[model samples]
Target: MELLELPLDEHLEAVEKAIGEWTEQQKRRCKSAQRTSSVEVAKSEEELRELQKQKLELLEAIKQAEVAREQQKRRIAANENETRDLQAEIMKAEPIITSLKSRENLHQGNLGNLNQESNKSAQAHAQVVDELMKGISLYQKLGLLIDKKRENNLAFIFTQLDPNNPNREFSFSLRIEDNPDVFLVENCVPEVSDVNELLDQLNKTGNISTFVRAMRLRFKNLV
Candidate 1:
């Protein structure tokens, strides 16, 4: 009976040793799996943080874009307002601009007319000067002295009447008041007998120089 008990005790000790080794192996495996799970969880947390950072950056970009769009819309609206104002101003000033253009054209026309009238006046003045020069030359050549007392009155003196009477002068005055074709003679130096007949011839011929020459000849005959 002692020998059978000793063998049974040794078998029981062996069985207990086997069970403890298996439990130790299971504990080591569980610890390794927990370490791996912890590593995976850390990696997942880092990826989540990266995704959140990216989302924040995207949101900021969208916000900036929205602000830029708002600013652009405001600028566009302001430009439209300015354009409308400019159009209104142009509409208001259209009539004034047209009136100014018309006035400028009228002023140019008036200047043109004034230039033409000045040219005509210069031409008439030149003609009158030429006629006056001709009359002065004719009087000088005929040895006649004419003095204008008024617009229609004149005094005439014949200087070269007779060679013997060198100092003798035949003077007369002619006046025209009412009639342009008729002349009144007065202030005769020599009392001519055919003075009325000479005046009739002068009225018929309308030649004052011929009448003066005839009077001079008549005075020479008397001398």
Candidate 2:
């Protein structure tokens, strides 16, 4: 599947600048071509004909640009909605899985320990995993890069942690060619906390000194 993610405002600005320059060049070229084709426009009919053609070309260019802009807005909106929905799904699953874990510890052995709690925890975990995978797949479809630090969030983690450590290695790294927004943990256990929030802050915080100060507060492990 293709990797698709939302472009931040800066990226959209760059796109607008590039498009504006291209459109200006196109307008100039069209006017130049018309100059080369100019004839005796002393006649009102001929002048009107030329004006009509130039106006039509400009109108076409405006329409094309508008269509492209609207499409980008739609794509960005859809991606944001997808993230919110997936986050909500994970939030809903959190309590159920935590409850199952506590229940399992309370009833671990008997002549017939049903293991129902364990099964539910396993199932709840699976549901979270599945939802995350879907989120990742949707990211792949968006076709934008969300990372400035590295590739996806998964790669950012791997680069920080040692792969040889049993507890550090992910089952596999979640990678999408140009996007960093859809990293998901799999098979292997992850450091339990809010990794997504960490990534979001990293992207949002552009300056290094500010980020360090924020990290000290958020992780609480920093000296």
Candidate 3:
């Protein structure tokens, strides 16, 4: 009986040892699986954080786009108001501008008429001057010389008194005045006492050539 009991005890011990080794192996496999699960969880958490950051940035961009769109709408409204005001002002000014243009056209027509009258007067004056110059040329050969000055307002008369002394001259100046229209004699080389009487006759008759001839005859008698 003792020998049979000893063999049974040895078999039991072997079974117990086998059971302990299997339990240790199962514990090691469980710990390894837990470690792998922790690594997967950490990777998933990091990915989730990155996705949340990207979502916040996208939301901020959308908000900024909305603000810019509102500002653009306000600017467009302001430009439209300014455009309408300018158009209204232009409409108000149209009649005044038309009246000013009409007045300008009327003034231009009056100026044209005045210019035509002025040209006709100048032509008539030129013809009169041409005839006077021709008469003066004829008188010059008869020992009478006339010099006009001060826009024809002053006249210088030179007369040869003595036929033998052709170089001897009796010279006098006559100035014309507009108020009452009188001829004033000035700077007579040989003073004549009857010059005022002769000037009165010339002014009354408005005959300058006849007075010059008579004055030359008087100077010749004195010589």
Candidate 4:
């Protein structure tokens, strides 16, 4: 029962058995540490894959935004070009519009002048008619039976007759031509007459009585 009494071989065996147990415990601890290191490596690799995927998505979004920006720029440029062309067309039409307005004003002015000239010609013709009626009244006052027999293009025909005998008659005519200055006498039986000679004498003498005396002498039978 005492230590000294125990055998030496038994003591040696006991020491060897304890050493083997310690070695086995250290091997198990080594295996557990290796498993934990492998799990950590797997987790790190999964995190890296997630980060790479997020970066790729960001790159794709950036590319899409750039393409939209380029499209907007093109649309703006096209609109600007269309506006410029429309302005150019408007500028080209302005002169033609002005020219047409000027022509219309000119035509209106010419029409106004023509209307004034027409009114003046009408007034002059009315004056000539009034003077001719006065001359007819004077002939009637001279005791001559003057009858308006007929009318033609250039003259009015009148027959001067002796009141006692209708057959003893002379034909007198008053004529007007386009020229207002010219005076005419036609069909004088006793002598060919130029009334212009009397008008010239009247202009020189400035005497209405002399002019009347000349007219009476020229138409002595009717006077």
**Highest lDDT scorer:** 1
| lDDT tens digits by residue: candidate 3, 110-155 | 9999788767655644543455566567767766666666543445
Candidate 3 clashes between residue pairs 3 or more apart in a chain or in different chains? none
Q: How close is candidate 1 to the true structure, as a TM-score?
A: 0.44
Per-model TM-score, in order, reads: 0.44, 0.24, 0.53, 0.33
Ranking by lDDT: 1, 3, 4, 2
**Mind sharing the TM-score for model 2?**
0.24
Candidate 4 TM-score, C-alpha based: 0.33
What shift in Å separates residue 101 of candidate 3 from its native position after superposition?
1.6
**Taking the tens digit of each residue's C-alpha lDDT, what string does model 1 give over 1-223?**
9999998999988888888888888888889888988999999999999999999999999999999999999999999999999999999999999999999999999999988876775565455434544555575555677777665567777776667766578777876534244667888888788988999897786666677667777766777
Q: Residues 158-219, candidate 4, lDDT per residue (tens digit)?
A: 23434565445444443333344333445544442666787666546544445444555565
Best by TM-score: 3
Question: Which run of 10 residues does model 2 get worst, by summed lDDT?
Answer: 151-160
Off by over 4 Å in 4: 1-22, 90-223
lDDT of 3 at 59: 96
Residue 153: error of model 1 in Å? 39
lDDT of 2 by residue, 116-153 (tens): 65455456545544554444443333221222233232
Q: Name the candidate, 1 or 2, with the larger TM-score value.
A: 1
Model 1 pairs whose backbones collide? none
Error (Å) of candidate 3 at residue 102 is: 0.9
